[model samples]
Target: MQFLPQAPTDRHTTLEDLQGIVTGVTMVALSVQFLQAAELITGQIAGLSLVASYPTGLSFGLVFFLLNLPFYVFAILQIGWRFTLRTFLAVALLSALVELMPRAFSLSGVHPGAAAVLAGISAGVGLLVLFRHGATLGGVGILALWLQDRTTLRAGQVQLGFDLVVFTLALFLLPLATVLWSLLGAVILNVIILTNHRRDRYIASS
Candidate 1:
């Protein structure tokens, strides 16, 4: 008897994939808490929330979650339900996690220089995980992906352009040295995304 070979299939997400998204967003939230404690901001929605929170005395978690709401419609229409739902969950969980992170640990001994670099590393790694899992932390990421699909530009480029605007705002709100370090963190985050998140290289459902 001849045996039949298996047909090609699109790999679906496993339980592990779901868990990774949660873990990744948690890392990102923790990183945001670090940035907040240092009174530094990075870029994109996270940075925007940071800037707003500093002035308004509102919670960054609340601001971040609210800021991401308008983009979910675009996200669903462009990326599909799985991606959108995962993004929503990640964003919501991140919002909650950020609130909890400060209470969970003390940052008194942490230096600004170290906090900035660690924030970048943790954020970059977390975002890398989210991207591979076919999800995002939402906000500008959804807009960037939508714009990239419509234009000749790459998503990374669109994100970087927006990040520059966020950093410029940081200049007014934070000390010059702090903004410079924040820029460094932004660069590290972009380097991670641009280098590792290639579509042709990593094929997964999105």
Candidate 2:
């Protein structure tokens, strides 16, 4: 019987990494638009930022960027400086993009259900792109990827577990129906990563 390669044969070029990071962050920024339009939240630091932003009158970008600051130490210690740097860059870009997108293109009249699904799809694919390029958006993503590398846990599963906690806390802050719709988006995002991001199935290194 034949089997797929279990190891990465080559590293991504510098230019490839650049484009990948840009594309990934852009898609994620787009996802943020959908979430904001519906006032729905997803998982991870991004969701926490939204929750905080709503009541505090803070920009999601500013809150997200600040929330990620402390995680850089954890990311550097756990994943190495190169990965940490890339993650920082990705996070910074996403923060800026989320702010800029709203100014350039506005979204309205989007149903929460459709927004949830669209956010899930875009964010999932975006995160996959970032992961393949050896980067993340920081915070929970950093921990999730580290656990996936060190233990038997899948990154998506670890993230989903974290998501549940975030959602639980969110219940106290957000409307019940809003939280439920947001949960659907989170589930879809994690399911995509759970199914497609196994080391055994995809071995390409950035």
Candidate 3:
């Protein structure tokens, strides 16, 4: 199977990569701030970061970046060089954004409940944009989506299963009520994709 680079390339390859990198970093930085305030864990790689943030004093961006490194090999082997490069750019962007955004913008108090909903919406919108453009936030999510395409299992189920495990861990670490609320946010995120992320309508119109 062939995978196209999610973002368009320019005459200068460096420029194209730089664009992806910048996008990745910005999205992740905003994402982390939301996550931190909301106490909600996102799907896939971000979820892992949510768990890791507890034991490790490292920032979410650092943990998120390191955790995703192993998956780059999978992206390379399964997807191809173009995809790997795009994923690399995305990963780098997210790492940089998460680390730098807070310094640039001062974010104050947030209501965790509201933050969870807002974070879910923000993440879902950001991810949908990336996916529509032929890019992705690097994680096992890309692999999981591919697997679901090839197999009988649904992509939503795969993601939900992973999320459930992460939330369960969260429940143990935090409070059960928080876990439940976070799941609500996850549900909101998935709903946005399921309804609006389809290409068939756009393709037909075009």
Candidate 4:
């Protein structure tokens, strides 16, 4: 009988990892600032949360935080408790930052097209940072991570599909021009993840 070598355990995140999470989330909050400034939307749960909060008196941060609640089970079960907890922390950090960003900063004359592009790029980089550190922002990502764990599928592909569905729903919630611009952002965002976040590419370090 041939014996297989055991897989090495991943090292726990360090203080630098936590700082990276903060920095990444701050960038995401900056992206959200642009999105709200233009009254535009992108794909993923963030878009859904924006749509849900549009007519209501509730805040975007609250809606976004609540929207992610359902994915914890998948995160914990498939990705492990550490990942789940880190994700929850990331989501909470994103939520707080989204709310705080508007108060701390504002932009004038930001075109919707520019907003979409900037928001997509900023959020993509932000998410990449989280992904590298073994975390996510919850929602479709949790599902993507779980699916990636169980199958040969790449998490980015799974995320792209979910992003498309959310963008389709954006049609009903936003203007045609806004949705079109958002589509561009979604494509950019998905492309970033698909190109950079492959399971085969992001090897674990000791």
User: TM-score for each prediction?
Assistant: 0.88, 0.97, 0.79, 0.90
Misplaced by over 4 Å in model 3 are 1-25, 152-154, 202-206
How does residue 175 of candidate 3 score in lDDT?
75
| lDDT per residue (tens digit) for residues 59-81 in model 1 | 99899899999989988887789
lDDT score at residue 4, model 2, on the 0-100 scale: 57
Best-to-worst ranking by lDDT:
2, 4, 1, 3
Model 4: runs farther than 4 Å from truth? 1-13
Give the winner by TM-score: 3 or 4: 4
Query: Model-by-model lDDT, in order?
Result: 0.82, 0.94, 0.67, 0.82
- Candidate 3 C-alpha lDDT tens digits along 147-166: 65577764455666777777
- Which whole-number lDDT from 0 to 100 does residue 168 have in model 1? 88
Top TM-score: which candidate number? 2
TM-score for predicted model 3 compared with the true structure:
0.79
> Every model's Cα RMSD, please?
4.6, 1.1, 6.0, 4.4
Writing each residue's lDDT as its tens digit, candidate 2 over 94-189 gives 999998897898999999999999999999999999999999999989998899998999999999999999999999988999999999999999
